[model samples]
Target: MKRFIITEDGSHSLFSAQFNQQYHSLQGALNESEHIYINLGLRPALENGPVSVFEMGFGTGLNAFLAWKLADQLQKQVFYTSVEAYPVSMLEASQLNYEEATGEKGFMQLHHAPWGKETGISPFFYLRKEITTLQDFTPDRFFDVIFYDAFDPQAQPELWTEEIFTKIAAQTKPGGVLVTYSSKGIVKRALAAAGFAVERHKGPGRKAHILKAIKL
Candidate 1:
């Protein structure tokens, strides 16, 4: 079962009983997404022109919501495709306080968008939420940015393996980038082994370091 919990920053994050983990940082869900994903991941990728983004886990649609908010502000078009083996229920998503926190209503539409097909929430934002896992996902078009937002290796080690990163790297466009909230040595080495020139960046809140890897 999944339940919502308020973080230190007064934002909601999901606590997954199956994984025994909180989907986002305990400090603040919205803050972590904005800093790690929107700032470090999506913002820099926009410099490359219109971007296609692939997210590893669409746990609560927070990252997608933030991406849409930023993309709309910049008048940039974004095609976001996020993969999740187990998606959150409508009730669970509704319980989230993201809309109130971000002061944006697009967050609701993002959660309501149908899975397995593209849906446009705004003129600049298009989303396709895939009901699958990264291991089984095959992209028809390579993406400019990949948000590797899976649970920590401690909770789900298989998704953090080199073999999986290698498969994902194949779908990353040359010069494209992959960002994650993890700076584990193995994670960096796996990304490097898979063809990314990885770099470490300052993390949000309690996190010490995060990773940004450019596909080469």
Candidate 2:
């Protein structure tokens, strides 16, 4: 597997091999995750009560970092779960500084906090990182918010299939929202087949659109 690659946007980072691209840039992947998913999809639901956030690809732990910081801000109890087949080494993990990027340092504790089947990182967030393949991530618990931030469908085609989404749908509570940076026809159809009310939303950078599917 290619350990690292640079994006066309000049963003450099490590590759998960599963997705075939670096998770995000040193400059703005943190910003985009916090702004798009955490602010838009997660914040509103948090205002009501405790928040449950599930991430498909926990690469570099950027999304999880942003989720923890936002949970602190919103004063919402947070349960964050992420699945990854390849967990980066501590050296590799240290290379990416999410705090400087997003102005959220609280996330750094998540890694140093420890790794296990289930653990609590802070008062607001209960984090669980499963070192297992995405296809093997059978959900024993449902989520209120699902962050479908996996690799691009082009690189990891199987992750975008209808059958995969059917499993994803099973984890989502009714009225739960699934958000991602992909808006392909097959992707949307698969989400629909899984019983989501799908919609196209504005994307972060050069990308024109993103997908937000509400489970019905």
Candidate 3:
């Protein structure tokens, strides 16, 4: 398999590969994540203190990068836990040219952060990055927010099942939120069956909708 692929979407650039894909267009992905989840949802909650962010697919680390920047603004410590089965090596990882696409030097720093033997990235960000398949892993804590950024449910059917959502719900605090780009009936139903109060909200670019569930 190709280690890295610089794919283009119209005028937008996406760094893609076997494990991750990111729209390199200056916070295109980052902005969407921060705007919808953090700025609008998690930020309000973080006014009291720091927030712990758990992501299903860390992907290109774009979401983690955005969370780091948001943490600075909110003055909140963030604990990020993301699972990736295939992590791109540093050589291939460096091929991601988000800085060139976004004109921001900081975008590059997010991916370069140290990974834990099992538990954290840095003092400010606690990263429990288990470089293993999601199906084989389990959660450790009740997070404030969950970013379900896994690949499409059709491509990876097992990741979207009732059992998986049930596991995800187990790791969240009561009333915590889980946001995702999918609002399919099966997906929502699975989440509800697992005990979350699911809401279908408007998605970015696509007017259809997305899922925002509150833990009860």
Top lDDT: which candidate number?
Answer: 1
lDDT of predicted model 1: 0.91
Give one digit per residue, the lDDT tens place, for model 1 in 1-216: 597799988889999999999999998898999988899889988976799999999999999999998999999999999999999988888889998988888577988899999998888899999998888888898999999999999899999888998988899999998999989988999999999999999998978999999999
Least accurate stretch of 10 residues (summed lDDT) in model 2?
A: 4-13
Name the Cα RMSD for model 2. 2.5
CA deviation > 4 Å runs, candidate 2: 1-12, 16-19, 25-27
Quote the RMSD, in angstroms, for model 3. Answer: 3.7
The number of the candidate with the highest TM-score is 1
Candidate 2, residues 1-216, lDDT tens digits: the string is: 447644443434576664547676434575567656887678877977997888887777877877777778777788988888777777777766555655566655666656556677767888988888879877789898888877777888899988998898888999999988789998999999999999998777666778889999
After superposition, which runs of candidate 3 have C-alpha atoms over 4 Å from their true positions? 1-28, 100-104, 117-123
Alpha-carbon lDDT of model 2: 0.77
Name the candidate, 2 or 3, with the larger TM-score value.
2
The positional error of residue 216 in candidate 1, measured at the CA in angstroms, is: 0.8
Q: Which of candidates 1 and 3 reaches a greater TM-score?
A: 1
The worst-scoring run of ten residues by lDDT in candidate 3 lies at 4-13
Instruction: Give candidates' CA RMSD values in order.
Output: 0.9, 2.5, 3.7
User: CA lDDT of each candidate?
Assistant: 0.91, 0.77, 0.68
